[model samples]
Target chain A: IIGMMAMTLSSVAADHLPSWNEGATKRAIIEFVENVTEEGSPGFVPPSERIAVFDNDGTLWSEAPLPFQAAFAFDEVKRRVPTEPALAADPMVKAMLDGDIGKLLEGKHHDGLMRILALTHAGMTTDEFDRRVNQWAESASHPRFKRPYLELTYQPMQELLDYLRSHQFECFIVSGGGADFMRVWSERVYEIPPQNVVGSTAQVRYEMRDGKPVLIKTLDQLFVDDKEGKPVGIHQFIGRRPIACFGNSDGDQAMLEYTTIGNPHPSFGLIVHHTDAEREYAYDEKPPASGKLTTALEAAAARGWTVVDMKRDWNQIWSNPDAASN
Target chain B: IIGMMAMTLSSVAADHLPSWNEGATKRAIIEFVENVTEEGSPGFVPPSERIAVFDNDGTLWSEAPLPFQAAFAFDEVKRRVPTEPALAADPMVKAMLDGDIGKLLEGKHHDGLMRILALTHAGMTTDEFDRRVNQWAESASHPRFKRPYLELTYQPMQELLDYLRSHQFECFIVSGGGADFMRVWSERVYEIPPQNVVGSTAQVRYEMRDGKPVLIKTLDQLFVDDKEGKPVGIHQFIGRRPIACFGNSDGDQAMLEYTTIGNPHPSFGLIVHHTDAEREYAYDEKPPASGKLTTALEAAAARGWTVVDMKRDWNQIWSNPDAASN
Candidate 1:
C-alpha cells in the first residue's frame, strides 16, 4: 500500500509542479537541482552536501493580516488575561488587545513582542507547549483566507520542497518564527520534519517535575533567527553552508548573502516578491512598516538571484486555485 | 572504484570490531544494533529515525593531559601574545601561562575557560576560525601519548560509528567541546559531518568584511553543552529523540536519562568507564573534579545502561594495538 502511494506521489512530482508556471523561476530552480545532483557534472554536490534552506513567513505562507505567530500571541493574551489579572494590566498586553502594532513598534518592536511572547509562550513544559501549539494550529484560521493558517502555505514552494527532497537534498526551514511553534506543524504542513526546522528560540531550562525531566520555556530570548542573526543561526544549527536559500523580505537578505556570496560551489538564491495583490497581500515594495523589500528586490538582479514574481511565476498560489476572497 | 572501496570497507566490518575484545560489551552492542535494525521486529526503528549521539571528549577520543581544545587555547595565547600584548597581560592568560589550573578552577572554572577561549577562539571570521582549528589539530600532539591528538581516537568507537552508519544510522557528536573546533576535523576523523555535530558554542555575529560576508565569533557564551545542558543541546540541535546515546562522564547522565528514561521505543545507553590506566588515563571514578562518574556509575546498572570497563572490554584501544611507551 505504501509503495503504491509512493509511486503515485513520485509520478505527480516528475513533471507537474502544478502550482508553478513554466517560467524563468521554475526553470532556474530545476536547472540548479539537476546540476548539483548529476553525478558526472562539475557542479555535482554529493547528497551529504545537498542542504537547502527556506524562510517560513511570506516565502512559505501568508504573513499578512499579521504573522500567524503574532496572531497566536494576541489570542493567548486574551485567553490567559481572565485568570492573570496582572497580565491584563501589563502595557504590552494592553497594546496587543488594542490591536496597536504602531504603539508596539514605538520602542523596539522585538522588545514589545518578547514581552507578550514571554507571558503567552513561557513557563509551560515543552511537551505541554507543543500540545497547545498543535491544537491552536489545527483550529486557527487566517482572517483573510478563512482557512486554517497551515493551509495558507504556498503550493509552489511546497512543490519545490518536495522536488528538492526527492533529489536527495535535505530541506530545512530557517525561519525567524518560534522554533517550537514551527516544529508543531512543519512536518504535516510542509513535509519538512522537525529536525530540519530551525528558527528563533526562547531560553529553556531543564528541570525535574514530579520526578520527570521537563524543559520549561523561559522569558529570555535565546537567539533571534532574523536579519544578521539568520546567517549566525544557520551556522549555529545547520553547521554546513547551504547551497540554496529561499526567502522574502529585507530580513532574509543577510541569509541570502551568506549562502551565495563567495561560496565556491554552484549556489542559488531566490527572492519571493509579493507582486500579486489580487491573489495575496502585496506590501513588500510599498509597506507601511514591515518587510520593506525595496533594497533586496533591486539587489537581487545584480546578485544573480532569481526574483520570483508571484503574479507571473506561479500558476496558482494555493492548493485550491480559486480566487482568494479578501 | 567507489563501489569497490565501499565493498572492501564493508568486508572488514563484517566480523569483530578489531579493537574490541570478544565479551559482553561487544556482544551487547552488536545485539542492540541488530535488534533495533531487524525488519518486522518490535524493536525496529526506521532508517530516518535511527539517530545515535556520541559524546566527543573521552568517549570518541582521549581528553587526558587536558582536552585538546584547552591545550589549543594555551598554545593560541602564547602564539597571539606577540602580536597583541594586551592579551599577554590578561589574568586568564597569565594564569594559563603559569599552568595554574588551581587559579582557573577557583570561583568559576567555566568563566575562566571562556575568557581564554574568547581571546583565542573569537573575533575571527568563522571560515578563518575553522582554518586555524584545522591547522592546530594537525600539528598538536598529546603530551604523554606523543602523537597527534586526533590519532588518540579509540579504534573500537570508530568501528562502532562505522557499524552504526552501515546499519543506516545517522551518527551525531553531541559534545561539550566548541562546535567550531569540532567542525574543523570531525568529518575527516570521525565521519561525522559539521551538521551532525552539536556542541557548546560562543555567540557569533554576521558582518561584511571587505565586501565579503563573514560570521564573526563573539566573546559571549551561547551555550554550554554539558551536564543538564547536554539534553537541552540535543533537543535544540537534533530535534529527534535519539534511540542510543554514548558517553563516558557524569556530564552525559542527563542526556542518557532524557534519551532512554521516558522513551517508549527500545533504547540503549553505553558508558565507557576508563579503567585501563596503561592504555589511557583513568580519572572518572576518582577525578580532580572534571567528569566525576560516581553518580552515573551507580545509576548505570539500575538503568540497564551498559558500562564498558576499558581494561576488560577491549583487547586493544588504539588502532595500532601496540603498547605505547612514554
Candidate 2:
C-alpha cells in the first residue's frame, strides 16, 4: 500500500517536477517515505503531522552568486531604464542593468541588498509584475550555464517534492525572496502553486478601481522572509508548525529551528550545502552577495539537521539538463 | 492497512478535537475517509491531491451576532476607555464600549465593520495583541449559551479537520475575521496552530526597538478574507487549491467554487446550513448578523457542493453540553 501510494504521488509529481534524477536523493526520499507510511513503523507519521517546508532559491533549485529571482529583477530594471535616467545613474541599479554581477555584489550587507530589492520590485500591480517575470524567464539566460535561468533548477529536489507529496506531506516554498515573485513561476517549475509559496512581500492595498475591487501594491515595506522572518512567516501564514524543512542558507535557520521544535513525532530538517562546483557553483557560510548561511551551520549541527553535500549526495543536478543545454 | 491508517489518523484527530460526538457526523467522516484512501475507488485520492479548506466561524465554532474576536475587541476597548473620554463620546467607540451589539451592526457593511475593527484592534505590538486575545478567550462567555464562547465549537467539524488530516488532507481555516485574532485562539480551540489560519489582516511593520526586531500593527487595511477574497486568500496563503471545502454562508461560496474546480477526483464540498434554532440558532439567507447562505445554496446545487443541514446532519452540537449544564 505504501509503495502504491508512493508510485501514485511520484507519477503526479512528475507531471510538474520532471527534474529529479533517480538515485540517492530519490532512494533516501522513498525510504523515509515508506517508513512514515508503512503501518506500525516507529517513523509512522499521521497525515496531519505530515507538514513539509522547503526553501525556494537553493534547496529546490540553484542560487549561486545571487538568487535567480534577484537576477531577474536586475535584468528587468536594466530593460525598463530607457525612460528612467535616475535609476540608470544609480550605482546598484546600473550594475544590475549592465549584468555587472561583480559590482552588484560590492560592499552590500543583507539589509542593504533587501532595501535595493524593495525599491526595485515594490509598487507594481501583481499582474504587471507576473507578466514581467514570465517574459524575463522566457528570455533571460544564466551567465555560467548559458541557459534560461528557469532551467537551472535541481532535478533531485523536484523528485523529492513529488516523493514526499505521495506520502501525505504538505510542501511549501519558504524563502527570503518576494512571495509574489516566486509564486508567479513556482507552479511551472516546482508544481507548488501560488498559494503554497511563502516569502517576502511588499504592502498591497485593496481598492475599487472603476467599480472593480483590485489589490494594488504600495510603496511600503512588509516583512522580508529570511533568517528570523522565516519562522515568523511560517507561524503567521501557515498557522500550523511544519514537520519537515529544507533550506540552504542562514536565512533559513529560523525555519529549521521552528520545524525541529515540533513535538510527538520527530521532525526532519535538511540543508543543501553547495559543494558541487562543477555542476553548480559551490560556496558556504558566505556567498558574494548575501552572507545568510554562515551563522546557521553550528545551529544546524546542534539541531541535527541533515546537511546534503551537493557534489556527493546528488548524482544529477537538475531534471532537464538536455533541454537546458540546448 | 487502510483501516489502521484511518484509525491512527482518527486517534490523533480525537486528541485535538475531543468535542466530536460519535455518530453520523463521525460515520460520514469515516465514509469520506475510506473512499479517499481505499485503493482503486473512484473517490480514492492521493495525499498530494488531498487539500482541505475549512471555514473558521460558525462552521468551526460559533460566531453569531458578532464574531468572538469582535467581542474581545469590544471588551478590550471598554476596559481601556475609563481614562479616555474621547472614545466615550465617539458613537462607534461608545457603542462598542456600552456593549451595544446592535449599534455595532447598524448601517455597517463588511468593509465598514472591518475599518472599525482596524481602529479598535491596531496600534499594539504583536505580543500585546496576542495577550489580549488570550485573556479575552479565557473569560468571555456567549450571551445565549452562557458558556465561555471558546467552548461553543461545532464538535463534528473539529472531527472533520482531524479526519481529513488523517487521510492526508491539508486543512486550513479561511475566514473573513482578522487573521492574527483567530490565530491566537485557533490552536487552543481547534488544535490548528496559527500558520493554517488565513483571514483579514491590518498592515504590520517590522521595526527594531532596543536592539530587538518586532512586528507592530498599523491601521492600514491589508487583505480581507471573505466572499471573493476567500479564494484569493487561499491562493495567496495555501498556494495549493483545496480538494475539499467546508463553509456556511455566501462568504464561503468562492472557496467552495475554488475547491470544486480542482482536477476531477472524488472531491467533496460541504455547506453547513444552520437549521437547529433550539440547539444552535437556525437562519439562512436572511439573518442580520450571520445570515447570507442564499447564493451558496444555489451555487452548491449547481456546483454539486453538499449542503449539510446542521439540524439533520449533526447528532449533537457542542462537545460537552451535558458538562455545561452542570
Candidate 3:
C-alpha cells in the first residue's frame, strides 16, 4: 500500500502543472505538447513552427470588476484630474472615477471613452508611456484579490507557458488590451517578452522634439486585437499561424477557429471555462463583461476543442498551491 | 618563406566576410557583433536583444530602373487589361503600361495610384494575396539584371544576415514595400521569416464568406512604412528597439535614428552608399528614386554611423564568389 502511494505521489510530483488537476483537460495539453515535440512522431512540429498564442485578460488572470487596462486608465484619469480641474469636471472623468460602467456604456460613451483614452494613453512619448506602465504595474493592486495585479495571473497557465517554452515552443500573448501596457510588465509577470505581445495599438507618430526624434502616441486607434481581429493580429505580427491557442471568451472564438480549423498540421485549441466562483469569477453562458462565451461554448463541442472547467480542472488558480486545500 | 606564405593564406581564409574588403566598415561590424555577443563583456547583449533591422529596397537588393513592386503592379495591369476593357481605358492604367512615370507623378497621380493599388493589391483575401505574391515572386524578373528579382539581392548583405544570425542575432527586414509581398519569399530569399518582416500594410477586414472566415485586403492605405513611419512600423511589429540598423537611404534615416540614437545599449548603425555604377547603380548624392540620401549622408559621419561605400568596400556584389574575377 505504501509503495502504491509513493508511486502515485511520484507521478503527481512529475506533473509539470502542479496547479492543474489530473484529468482529460490536463492530459490533452500534455499529450499535444508531447506529440508535437517527439522527434519521430507524425505530428512532430519543428521548433520554428512551434508557436503558441494565449489571450490575456480573463484567460491569464482575473478580469473581474473590470479589465485591468480599464482600471489603469481610470487611475490615470484620477491622478491627472487633480492638476487639471477641467478634466475632473468632465462627466466621463467623473463616471470613470466612480467606477460607473453604466454611464460609460451609454451611446455617448464612445466619445467619452475616446476622451479618456486620449487623455490617459496619448500625448506622451513611447518611452514615457512604457515607464508609466511599469510604474503602474509595480504599485497597482487588484481590488477584490487585494494583491498586486501582476500576481493575479493563473498559476496553471504560467506553468503551461514554461512547459511549452521548455519544449522549444515560442509563446506569444495575443490580447485585446493595450499592447504597450502589457509589454511593459509581460516579461516580468509572464516570461513572455515585449516582442511577443500583440494587442490593440494607438497611432504613434515619429517627430523631432527638441532636435531629437521621439515617437508620440496619438489619440487615433490603429488596430484592435479582438474577435476576428485576433487571427489577423496573429498573422500581422507573427506572420505564422499558431498551432496551439488558449483563450477564454467569445472574443477568442474566431482565433480558435482559425487555429484548429483548416490547418494542415495538427493543432490544439483550449478554452478556460471560468466555473470556479470561489477561486475565480464564473461567467460562461452569460457574462457581464465583454468576454462573452455563448457562441464559442456552443461550438467548442462540435470543433473538438477542450473546454477546461476551471472548478474541476484547476486544483489551484493563483500562484498559491495550497489555495484549494485552504 | 613557405611557412609565412601558408600563415598568410590561412589568415585570409579566416575572414568571415570574403565579399567585404579590408576596411573600417567590415571591422566595425565584426567588432560590434563580437563585443555584444562576448560573455561577461560590458557591451554584451543577450541573444533576445540582439535584433538587427535592415531596409529592403536598395540595401538588400537593386531598386534601380524603378522599384520591383512598381514593375509587378505594371505587369498586373497589363495582364488584367484584357479581361476588363474599362480598366484598360483608365488613364492610370494607360500611364502605367506606357511607362510614362511623369504623368503618374503629377498631382492627380494620387487617385490613379490608389486605383492601381486597389486593382492590383486589394479585393482579395489575405491567403489569396499571399498566393498571388508567391506566384509573382516565382515569375518576376528584373528588367536591368535580366534575372529573377530575388537574385538581384546584394551578396554582401546576404553574408551580413548570415553572420548576424550565426552570432545569435535576430534579423528583421523593415521595408517600405508591402509586408505580404515580401513575406511570400523572404524566408527562401533572405532566410528572414515572415514574422521578422515589417513593412507597409494594407487595411485587412475580417469577414465570413460562405461559412469561411477570411481576412480581405481593402483599398485603403493603412500605413506607409517609410521615413517617419519606419520607426512606428518597427515598434508596432517588433515591439523592441533593435541593436543594429542598416539602410541605404533617407527613407530609413528615422529607423536608424530610432535604433541607435537614444538606445541605452551599445548599438551600431550602417548606411550602404551605392557608389558602383558599373556593378550596381550609384545614386547616393543625387539619385532618381525616392531613397535619396542627402541629409542622412551628411548626418551619418556626425552620428558615428559607418557609411559603406559599395564600390570600394565590397569585393563582390553578386552571389557568385568569382563575379569580381569575371
Reference contacts preserved by each model:
0.58, 0.28, 0.52
User: Which runs in model 1 stand beyond 4 Å of their true positions?
Assistant: A1-16, A80-91, A109-112, A287-290, A319-326, B1-18, B81-94, B109-112, B319-326
lDDT of each: 0.81, 0.71, 0.82
TM-score, candidate 2, chain B alone: 0.85
**Best-to-worst ranking by lDDT:** 3, 1, 2
lDDT of 1 by residue, A25-129 (tens): 877887787678766667989987888999988899888868888888887778779999999899978988888776666765567777888886888888888
Q: Tell me the spans in candidate 2 whose CA falls farther than 4 Å from its real position.
A: A1-55, A58-60, A69-172, A178-196, A200-235, A239-326, B1-33, B83-91, B98-116, B321-326
Ranking by DockQ: 1, 3, 2
Question: How close is chain A of candidate 1 to the true chain A, as a TM-score?
Answer: 0.91
Worst 10 residues of 3 chain A by lDDT: A317-326
TM-score of chain B of each: 0.91, 0.85, 0.91
For model 3, the superposed segments whose C-alpha errors exceed 4 Å read A1-14, A320-326, B1-14, B320-326
RMSD of each: 6.0, 9.4, 5.4
Docking class of 2: incorrect
Q: Give the TM-score of chain B in candidate 3.
A: 0.91
Best by TM-score: 3
For all predicted structures, in order, the TM-scores are: 0.89, 0.64, 0.91
Worst 10-residue lDDT window for candidate 2 chain B reads B317-326
